[model samples]
Target: MQGENVSLHCRKKDANSSYTAKFYKNGISIGSSSSGNIMAPTVSKSDEGLYKCSIADAGESPESWLSVADLGFPQVLPNRQQFFQGEPITISCEGLNGRTGWRVMKKINGDIRICASTWETLIGSCNICNAYPSTDSGEYWCEHGEIQKSNSVNITVSGHPTVPYFKFYLVLYTGLSLLLVVILLILAGLFQHHKHQQTIRSHTKEMSLTPDDDTLYSKAIYTTLRPGETELKGHKKRAD
Candidate 1:
């Protein structure tokens, strides 16, 4: 609460005498007033501590403890702590109030930097466009000045895995297709050759069943003799 007007007045018993007032926090001078009134515009947590007001010429007042209530703590967004190389990541540093000393801190390579300058800032968040292994792996957190800090978020990066398995399967499927085609062609050729052999065998069997022309048309000679007489007569005859 930095804007709430809270006034601390130091009034002495004698109203006629006017004295200047000086405010102190933990024995440290913070502000001074002429009319013995310390006006705190906003009571921030930083303003929490012992408070005392002193009269200019008179002695200092008794110390009074000024305690400020706690609001929500600072935090990060996109809660996962792991990341991949060349991957886009988003981080945020949020405090109780808007931009009230809320800053994002990254510790990498033994160094630290506010994310707003190096990373893109949008809607109160930081965007690391492409995370890498070199300077993007380490702890991150939300900080409110140097006192209050959020829990650390660790990030890790790794290389992308190769995809040769896909190519290997592709080549394997192609070889198998070619082998199947060759096998089918060989089967077809063998079937055709077997059919040709059967046709040739059928023709040879038919030829063996048919008689030769010379054997089928050969002529025979016959001779006849008369009774009690010898006579020689020969004639070629075609027998049915």
Candidate 2:
């Protein structure tokens, strides 16, 4: 099982002087001991591998495989059932017993995916830096091997509708500009019409004040005969 102390021993056949026993993991040298015994304390998933030891003159021992098993269930931090899009979340498989090697798994869109294999894992926990409603929303759990798995958690991600500030302001400004131009054009047309009407009225008043040709001739004749003929005309009318 995981998180357990492990010890390997190697013995030489004949009684001899002290010799250093070297330990190898997966054919690579790990450490050496003077007592012909090597100890690995609190072994985890990373410690599980092929192990062998050898003395200086003696031959190497047969390789043995180490297997680590998960201790408990998995847990999700923040422990929320609902989340918004673009939020970060973490899924941890470090159970109550402090065991490791349990992988985070999810079923999304009817397909299963393993974290750190499909996505990214940070500090031994599966991290979704930017979540999405369509892709990241699903059932999540932890699995140690093919048979052992923790309880699943249903997660729902909600997407919020957003409008671009630049585009929205651009549309608003364009509409206002067009409306302002229309208003200015209407005002200019009305002003021109008012000015034309004022000019026409001024010209008509000047024509009415001026004398015509017939009126001017009658006035001149009356002014020429006025002084002498005025009293004579009255006397002639009385005699008739």
lDDT of the structure predicted as candidate 2: 0.75
Give the 10-residue window scoring lowest on summed lDDT in candidate 2: 231-240
Off by over 4 Å in 1: 1-17, 22-47, 56-63, 68-77, 82-88, 94-107, 110-123, 138-240
Q: Which regions of candidate 2 fall more than 4 Å away from where they truly are? A: 1-73, 118-123, 161-240
TM-score of candidate 1 against the unseen true structure: 0.38
- Give the CA lDDT, 0 to 100, for residue 212 in model 2: 97
Tell me each candidate's TM-score: 0.38, 0.35
Error of 2 at 143 (Å): 0.8
lDDT string, candidate 1, 181-215, tens digits: 99999999999999999999999999999989777
Residue 112 lDDT, candidate 1, scale 0-100: 87
Give the backbone clash total of model 2. 0
RMSD of 1: 13.2
Residue 23 accuracy (lDDT) in model 2 = 93
